[model samples]
Target chain A: MTTIITAQNLSKSFGSFQALKNVNLTIKKGQIVGIIGANGAGKTTLLNSILGLSVYDGDLNVLGFDPYSQRDELMKEICFISDVATLPKWIKVSEAIDFVEGVHKSFDRKKALAFLAGTTVPLDKKIRQLSKGMVVQVHLALIMSIDAKILVLDEPTLGLDIIYRKKFYHQLLEDFFDEDRTILITTHQVDEIENILSQVIFIREGEIALEADMEEITENWMVLNPTADNIDAARASSPASEQSLLGRTSFIFNGVSRAELEKLGDVSRVSLSDLFVTLMKGDNDA
Target chain B: MIASIIKPGGYNPFKALMLREYWENRRAIFTTPLVIMGLSMVLIIISMGLLGRAIHIDGQSYTLNEMIANMSAQKAQNISTHINQILMVSTLPIMIGAWFCMVFTALGSLYDERKDNSILFWKSMPVSDLQTVLAKLLNVMLVIPFVAIGFTFIFQIFLLIVGSFSTLGTDYSAWDLLWSSSNLPLLVFSELTYMVMYSLWALPVFAWFMLVSVIAKRSPLLLATIPVALVILFETLFFHSEYLARFIGMRLTGAHILQTDNGFGQNFSILGINTPLENIQSAAKPEFWIGLGIAAALLYAAILLRKRSSL
Candidate 1:
């Protein structure tokens, strides 16, 4: 596998507060990695450090160069779209687009303009005048216009409505993503991008709590529904997500074959959200 | 699957950032200098009325050619005082302009990007930290002064043109102000150069602001100004020190205006022998240059920090 990012022992502190503590991560090319965590769990900090926005004490290599020292050069080949409404409020949509065109060599003006085709974003109207959702659309259009090898999208759907968020990801998948491209997306809402992700990386308090392949996840993470009489048998299997309703136990396990899990009772595929919750709690216990 | 685009020895990313910032500001107020200068000319006419002065020249034949000279550096220190007042008062506004530009641009430069968490875009690029720092340094310290120069030059010209005509009944004339002896081109060029140099010398201040902007959570310019204000308060309440005043406190008042050795004239007094133009102190000194160098270095340090800083 060709490695796209390798972060080792990365740590960052803001005065009295430590934002990140000894985080390590490695991502491969042509893989879509989904990151999920609660707020203030150092998810943003990790992405920021990777992007070379904050000074951190650790080692970071993105596309084979130290992120801190090689930000500008590395940026040309990477597409980072954090907030949805990133364009300046004073700039017209077209002016902002034109400005990006002039600044970024990889920015495709025609593609971005085409993305806005038939939209109400009058190229002349200032960004402040546009609706909030429209602003997000404009920013997304600009991001997709740039042909970067790696894409880091941090909460790109924040502030966007449900419909737009759905449409946004759909369009992103339709137009931007491909086998040769890599994307790292971080969000608490795991179920939305579930189908598209090849891997799930769960970060908890500045540490990679879990990293699992999609195939392995379904294979191991099985929510078991069995009568209380068989709970002892299910428990013996080290079920990860086990619930008791009237002492009728339900369990999820990892590292067990699907056929083996069926022997326990009522084994089925686990949703990414269920998998994230189960894996986080079960951890090494399972 | 790793792309080969990030090889060593490629295009500089710092230059791209510099160009981006420059173009944004240039688009915002590219013609501001000329406009401000024209407005200043109108103000000059009003100032002439307040001074109750008429424009004329008597050293040669009474003509427009002779009258412009009278509008120049004082035939008697009267013009010097007027120029001094204009320079002294306007220094604040120009500085305000510079401060506003530096604070706004620097505030937006890294802070806005960080606020949006656009470090991802920047981080993926192949440019080095040093290049990023260099571009920011050049934008604030270099491009700003040049923009200011454009404004000052246009402002001076406006003053000369209207000041010459408004003094119709007095010692001022368009020809005299334009031709008589001032050598408008050289004088204006010298003044503009002095302005540029002063800004360059003070590059550290703007750089400091940029650093604050990059790291500060919010309102970096305001936050930074408090220290400068506290220094002044403490110095005033306690002992006096010229060194501190010259180094930091003096910058607060901005007393020195464009110190150019124009070599206009050598003054002689009736009571005592006068120092010749050659004996006068030069505008530039080693100490100032040293300070300038230190400031430039400080500005560069900000750039380096910004290069690696998230957002």
Candidate 2:
């Protein structure tokens, strides 16, 4: 697979505080990578650097161009949904379509209108008149209409209800994703998107804590709930994290064989949320 | 997908950017001029009714129609000059309205996008920051003034038609009474020339507003004003000079240094017909070129600020 994005020793700072510290990464084509991080954990800083919205130091490239210096050229093949409700409130739905069609060479007016036809968004109404869910719907329709190679989403469904949130991701996967495209997403709601993420990166305090493919993570990492007498032996295996819920204790292990973990107790593949929490706690302990 | 592979060539992004500005500020750019036309039309009709009454010129009473018919060649020429002056100067209100529109629009053009977080959406587009900033700048400098001029032309034509009707049932036809006496084509040419010259003269101020809009996080108006105020105050307090203040005044008012009296007040009497051609000569002044250079610098700074700014 072709590499779509590459960053080597990438760094950014705001006044005294450094936001991203020497982040080196390479994303391959057709990968849906989820960047999981807590607040002030440099997820946005990294995204901004990748999207060329902010200045950064060191080598960085996306789609064979330096994003910061060549953002206009990069944007011809890249589309992003940065946060929710970003469409201008003064624009009519029809005007937004016309503007994108007028400016973006890759934009398809018929495709945008056809997507809107399935929604409740009215063409004549201003964006301010639409409901928050409807606004996101319109935004999604516009973005999906563009024939782009990479799509970046930073909390694209922040305040939406559960119904719209599910629908948003569902539509994206069903209509937008292809083997020729790459998607990068950052969100607080990890579980909802974990099923679709092929790769996961956990960032903490301006540093990348964990980066692994979904299959690799599931194949190597496992969680176990041992019997009362075997708890001490399970602890000997050195779990990444341990959680005690009700009267049962569960231990999460990394790079440990399932046959070994099954000897301790019942073992199963670790969930992404569990892995995220484990990685975060591991960082805190260090 | 095959059709999408072919890039859309007919679509011009610069034209789209201009249209975007118009769409966003349609009220200020378009409706304000139309409202002025509507108000002026109402006032003209009211004055027409009042003029229907008998007027006494040298104690000889005559109706409005009879008065124009009774005028001699020189007398009618004099009245025509004053009427032309009134018509030309009447465009002042619309221009003033457009000036205010330009100032506020420039101030809010960059600030409002950041305020609502829509800058991210705009930045996501393929257009360069230079294109975006230039579009807003030209919208205020060129587009608004021309739109105002269009409404002024419509109003001027309406008034001339009304003048023609007033001359009916008398010796003078519309041509002799209104059309022939007025040099409309020359007047229009002069107005357009004056607008272009004035926009160039005032370019620095608008550019300053846009720069302030790009830099200020909150209260762009206050941020824009306080620095200039401090400059003026500082100049007055210690330097004992008003060069900056006088330059600002000259830019705001259309009084070029090339004029003998240094003001437009004495430039004309009954008609300011010669002002346009005279204004054209102001382009040769060093200050005019200097103002353009300053505007270019400010606009470049604005583009850089926008490129670096985050939502």
Error of 2 at A135 (Å): 1.2
Q: Report how far residue B163 has shifted in candidate 2, in Å.
A: 2.2
Instruction: Kindly report the docking quality category of candidate 1.
Output: acceptable
The TM-score of predicted model 1 comes to: 0.76
Give the range where candidate 1 chain B is weakest over 10 consecutive residues by summed lDDT. Answer: B1-10
What is the per-residue lDDT of model 2 for residues A39-98, given as tens digits with 9 covering 90 to 100?
A: 999999999888899999999999998998788788888999987768999988987887
lDDT by residue for model 1 (B164-247), tens: 565567564545433343344544454445445555555556566666767777777676677767786688678674455465
Q: Write the per-residue lDDT of candidate 1 for residues A12-68, one digit (tens) a residue.
A: 888877777888888998998898877887888888887767778889888976766
